[model samples]
Target: MNPFSVFLRARYGKCFASREAIARHQQQAFAHLRRHIMPRSPFYKDFADQPYENWPMMNKALMMEHFTDINTAGITKEDALDIALTSEEKRDFAPMIGQVAVGLSTGTSGQRGLFASNKRERALWAALMLGRFSPSFLRSQRVCLFLRANNMLYERLGNALISFEFYDLLQAFDLHLPRLNKQNPTVLIAPAQILRLLAHAQNDGAIDIQPRCIISVAEVLSPEDEVAITDVFGVEVDQVYQCTEGVLGMTCRAGSLHLNEAYVHIERDIIDEASGAFAPIITDLTRETQPVLKYRLDDILIPDDEPCPCGCASLRLKRIEGRCDDILYWQKHDGGLQMIPSDLIRQAVATSQCEIRDYRAVQVGQHLLKIWLDTDDFALACQYVEQNLLMEAAKLNTQLPELNFHQGITSHLDQKRRRVIAK
Candidate 1:
């Protein structure tokens, strides 16, 4: 079957079916994709003889090193990067090499990554996204997507029933507000930080659009930001966990984040078994242009303990913990390094008695920690945060680092919002 047909079946037919059925569908898709990719992609040629499960894992570094040979689209890293960079600089998403679209990652993981997709892939992506993201596929709706960079993948969503608009994040919010209010989009998608800003705007009556479906993407949706956005919008905010690699997961009707098992297979690199925290080793079966077989991602995710009420048998995720790079390392008593989970630090700050509005923790040096707190009572919030962090460190059997409180810390427009950063 064609990719579009597969996407339609997965989106319209089998999405709400039993887990066994979905698994069978995925198995078939995986087999077909493996057969298709092995012949075209030189990077996977060595693993052609090996079982899919026995294949070696690939990472960003490995992908960058073998970029010329890995992609089946016949585009070099230099040419693709040139196109992507030019598009970013000129704010022109229409530039493409033949029928393939080249896009660059935000480089939050230290090294930026490039991705390419042909026309068929973009069409399939649009169909699948519409089926999963749109509130009602039958009814016509308008979509407003705020992104750091625009691409043909998003632009193709515009059709008779759906109107797609891309709002560049680099542009000021004030400039977009008037246009957004005029668009009156039925579906609004933006990063959590931008959503927070929009929430404030809506509260202040600066914007007057009521979207039926609101999605938080690009950034981790903090609990506080989620509540604020949901409360202001008067609707449950959904999330799309997409990256440079592929579309990994999206929120279901029951508000549970379920992995897109039909398009990808995930292997957990477990970090905390008790909490179901692990990094994802993804094998994106739908991708033929750029084969992503056994690719390890840096983002940490917590799998759901119970089955989703919606009964979609795909794997469910409880939460998206920050990146592994954000996990701070501390010196152990035995001269070894011990890692502190970002969740622990977030919990320490979130559970404080003070009315903490926003906060960030940065590990500046080996034994120094800088914290930024945005609250009415900065002194009290700072004191409470310090005490809680000290308690958390004590529980982890590590000495507390020297703590410094900072005020008015902000994330730049071009940078990814990270609550816990290790410098």
Candidate 2:
């Protein structure tokens, strides 16, 4: 192991790993964030003058509206997107912009955000990931990292024992499924949606290969999806909840989501059950290029109350709820908007013991609700759900709206299957 990685392992694992350690690390990391980026970065400097206690929170809309002023010191949003989108053609995509790497998201919520990382930042991420997910892989194991676009940070993991291969899911599954199965990858990291499809393929006798373990990323791994993926792969289906916003948290070996306490600080907004859903207020402590200080995220995160089996002291995140965009809009008696938590609805439906493997709720009109499930028992299950929803909706003080239950709601082109859809 390198000297820096050893130091990081001790500093992050031994020293700043528990709740007490996390507090101390955050204080030091926040101090360094202010000291290092505040002076040179214009985006951070503008907000640096604000009181630390009362620092303004930012969101994606604000970042998009003020793209130029909010970006990192030497990069622009347009330049970063152009470079990221064009990176597919380059052999060394990450080094195209020197030691810095630019990445863009699919922007499922309308506008994509830009993420930049220098060599040191990339190494820190790599080390943390390696330490948590595959300590064995670092010595000798083949790792397959599935991504939409290739970058140096992702590609640099290629080694003799740890042979890294990046495959784009955009390609035909038939083409790559065989290749991936042939490679016999030791560690398979991918989005949960893709994993679920692969699981389905295996059940249907299309693909016949097993991975040691599966690490899910990008989207929320639903309870049903988790079961299917885990069963098909014959391994534990863990999740890593991260994005362009920041490396918010990752699932530990014990199957609990532990925030990356050494690199980021988080403050969450808890929505009253009577209101709708809680959103996250994020602060990226390690972002030097485009410092995201007190940025609000659209995605939802559950509270950490259950004590984890894992001994890590970092704050726990139970589950990443749906995004703000996924919230269903409804009319109140006062003629205003009231939102419904899609995650809550999914939980209600999943708890029914109705054999509902997959489902989607689509709002056709103010008074219409379409519920689609992937089971033969959906009709009988929906009958019970219809009554349960009426009682549940009454608690929320909204009409149950017409309920139409259907079977087999096909997956979208993006491969994302939404449980609730509001028009």
Candidate 3:
């Protein structure tokens, strides 16, 4: 597929009129994949004719284990991982394996997976991102991205018309403020936490940047933080929910998060039946280098059954909740474990009437919860947060965990901000 073809395919190529139309389009995409893409992979060639259900389920561990065979580029896992690691260590992403660019997946702390994208794939990604999410096509805009690391795929977006700059998150957060104030990017992209930091800086008059578009990536942007950032910077925060797998989804013009069903087909792996919460198993139709077929991401997504006002037929989401591994549970009266969505805990602190600068909820034990809040009057904030959490627990009809409150937020700027974690 050509670079411009991705734009054509995403923007105007296919707009399903109904869910059934989406099904038919996905059917054709899978057919094309089975006929052309699957035959190229040694790992999948034998299973090309098998039923969809018969295809193996993939995850980070399995992908890494079968990397060499799974990729069409004929590169081994060791070589790819080595190249990716070296690039990250040196903070230089210029090295390439032939025409293919290799990068590492930054997930929850263990067994970081390797991802490969050929030159064509990189161009397509750039086109899709620019075509779909760019703030304006008519003006010469500067797009600034704050990321843990940079890759060739991200670099592809920089050209004569657009000035694209990547700020390494590995550097101290304070170091970027001066440069950002001077750049005054037209489009600002960063993880939700970094955006929150920037919002605070802007509020304090430390940095003055009025980005026309603010895009949150890499981390889940909670409703409170979104509001905080939007209140500080006058633009609604658009979210791009993506990972190493591919660009799974992004916010539409109506501010609803829609799965990128035009190119990526996602299967729901239900987690909470009552809430209709499920994890995403995605298959990217355009990824020929390293096929992402039936790849299950760890994130929990809450669906919105209502159609978006933007008239896009893609699946809508209420929120991209935290990872499955971080799902907090409470012991039930009937000896069962009941799931308490991390969002509820987030709300317990965020929705409190008192001002809360930041917080983290960690389930350290079966019945022990530790919370740290960064705000004026720490004791008062803790009391309010505890009461709210207990009220929620009572409403849910579950045993309340012991609330342990600390003085301030205990997290680093460089790490992906996870407000709620289960130990």
Candidate 4:
């Protein structure tokens, strides 16, 4: 990355005069991408002069199939995968292919995503993350991150001003408590599940530490969990909506989840107009090693049209409503299919008027919804949750799915939590 680009982005990336200004900035960035970056890649060189929309839509499997061609770096997919797998197995993610670091995404089932990030990309990422979320530039800050796997890109974040530490999620999570307490980090970044565990630990007086910022990443953070964490920590939990694709979005100072429009251009694949829910097709301006243009992710996002009080001209999200495949469809009175967001199911369980610890809902059949609830009163929780879901179905004028309730939590700590599932 250019020194000037890194400096300006880290300083005033989030500040936008207006929405139109954001668009104009994106236009210039995309043009630069086409002119300077695309020609280097054999795959994209052909499309350098074409409109961005004319480019082929990319997904995990397709990206992997053409990985050797898609990446600007001369590294082959087989070589990259070997490095990533070795890193994962040895639990040491410091190795890389030259200056480019390779990481794998444990995407849906058998389809895995291979991502390559150069030194510049890593530095740019550090700049953006520290710019918006870091407590202070002058003060030496310790940052703790928990993840299933580590990568060289993450290791690059460590420097004189920032003490970066990665807690391996594959290891026993309980073992991390002592280190966490000792570090007393200024920033805590982890999946929502790990953050919840820490929150519980804090609430139970098992551990004592108060970080300046708590960031939820990888997994979707429910509204209920967010409030519960805020109440326990006495600080609002921030969220960084990211995946192997890139750092797509993060929570603004006002605590609203806004797209990283300063660095990435996102095109909406509208799923539902009524709720403004859409899947994102991203074209990251900063990515040069592996260009992620018009790459559509399976995640479904509900966008907030109302401008945030912080006045960020970037797009704001109401919530991430799980994956597109996780979305359940019900039969309407008119015999049409009605799409139901995962949030509606989550809300039904959250507001069931019963004290609940954890829950998971899966659609086993067209009209069969399998649910698991962890609560003191299983019967009452089931009855209220079923009633709430039925009421919501009635409001939608759609047929209600049969609720089959079980009595325990189905999620494991090490794995990414998927509270809502559709099959």
Q: Taking the tens digit of each residue's C-alpha lDDT, what string does model 3 give over 93-196?
A: 76589988999867765558888998888888777877776777788888999987789888855777788888998898899989998999988999999999
Question: Which whole-number lDDT from 0 to 100 does residue 94 have in model 4?
Answer: 80
The number of residue pairs in model 3 that clash at the backbone is 0
Clashing pairs in 4: none
Ranking by lDDT: 3, 4, 1, 2
Candidate 3 versus the native: TM-score? Answer: 0.96
Query: Relative to the unseen true structure, what is the C-alpha lDDT of residue 416 in candidate 3, on a scale of 0 to 100?
Result: 77
Stretches off by above 4 angstroms in model 3 are 9-14
lDDT of 1 by residue, 164-199 (tens): 998988887789999999999999989899889899
For candidate 3, give the lDDT of residue 108: 67
True-structure lDDT of candidate 4: 0.87
Pick out the ten consecutive residues of candidate 2 with the lowest summed lDDT. Answer: 1-10
Q: TM-score each candidate.
A: 0.92, 0.85, 0.96, 0.96
Question: Whole-model lDDT, candidate 2?
Answer: 0.70
After superposition on all CA atoms, how large is the RMSD of candidate 3?
1.5
lDDT of each: 0.83, 0.70, 0.87, 0.87
Please say which candidate is ahead in lDDT: 2 or 4: 4
Clashing pairs in 2: none
